[model samples]
Target: MPLILFNKPFQVMCQFSPHPSRPTLADHIDVPGVYPAGRLDADSEGLVLLTDDGRLQHDISHPLKKLAKTYLAQVEGTVTESALARLRAPLDLGDFTTLPCQAVRIEAPAWLWPRTPPIRQRADIPAGWLALTLTEGKNRQVRRMTAAVGLPTLRLVRIAIGPYALASHPLLPGEWQEVSPLEMR
Candidate 1:
């Protein structure tokens, strides 16, 4: 089975199917039969795993498997201990409560690529970075959690899924590479 790691760019839809207004996976990846194991929002960027094996995809994406996904979030204000505590604990987001996860402040990574149409900046309000690892992924959950803590997310990037990491397998936006499925084990 082929396992592909793609560095999805912001604004790119996470599907092979065509979209009238935005770019899709088909625009970047040419490998046939492989589908995304999990989804990243069109507004988010970074590592997305694709594979031809249905079992592998199910294992990686199924919430019951509790696969850990880590993200780097650029938020609108300086992160505080209080906010970190709130994020580290289970958070209620109205529809569902997020499971407790690892949340910590991190310096903006030097290797991060700039977003094509850069995130908005304000002279008065400084932005900060956070590394959050969650076992359960809910729609727009990270963004909502950050907003609940009083820091709106300006940008989001998924850095890792389980054993694979963007740091170890570097790829610029829209780039992808194949790896042996054994490596995932």
Candidate 2:
């Protein structure tokens, strides 16, 4: 099995195909036959795994598997206790209700790299950092969750999926490293 851990850069598309107007995984990844196990929105940045193994892809991306994904968010306001409480509860996002998850305020992670074309800065509105762990991946779920509670997400980055941490492998944006099935386990 071919396992790849890639640090997806901001503005990069998740798929391996060439897009008409946007950069795709093919722009950075060259290993044929491997596909991204899951997707990250072009506006979001994070760790992404690619694999040629179909079963491993299913295990990693399937929501039913309930693999925990850790995220570090820069939200556009002081993250209030009420906001944290709301995030920890089963909040509804119109389409569906979310399961309870761990949410907490955290200092900026030292390992975080500066985003190119950086998130807009505000002279007045304060921003805060938060660490969130969710068992399922939803479409822009973190952004919607924070927005619902009056805190808009400025930037979002997935630091890990399950036990595979981006920090543990030390990959920079658009960089990829190969790993073993045993190591992934």
TM-score of each: 0.98, 0.97
Candidate 1: give the clashing pairs: none
Q: Give the alpha carbon lDDT tens digit for every residue of 1-185 in model 2.
A: 78999999999999977899989999999898999988888988989999999999998999999999988989999889999999999999999999999999999888789999888999899999999999988899988988988889999999898878887988999999998867555
State how far residue 15 of model 2 sits from its true place (Å): 0.5
Q: Which stretches of candidate 1 lie over 4 Å from their true place?
A: none
lDDT of 1: 0.96
How many clashing residue pairs, candidate 2? Answer: 0
Q: Candidate 1's residue-wise lDDT over 131-164, tens digit each?
A: 9999999989999999999999999999999999
Window of ten residues with lowest summed lDDT in model 1: 176-185
Off by over 4 Å in 2: 183-185
Which of the numbered candidates is closest to the native, going by highest TM-score?
Answer: 1
Best by lDDT: 1
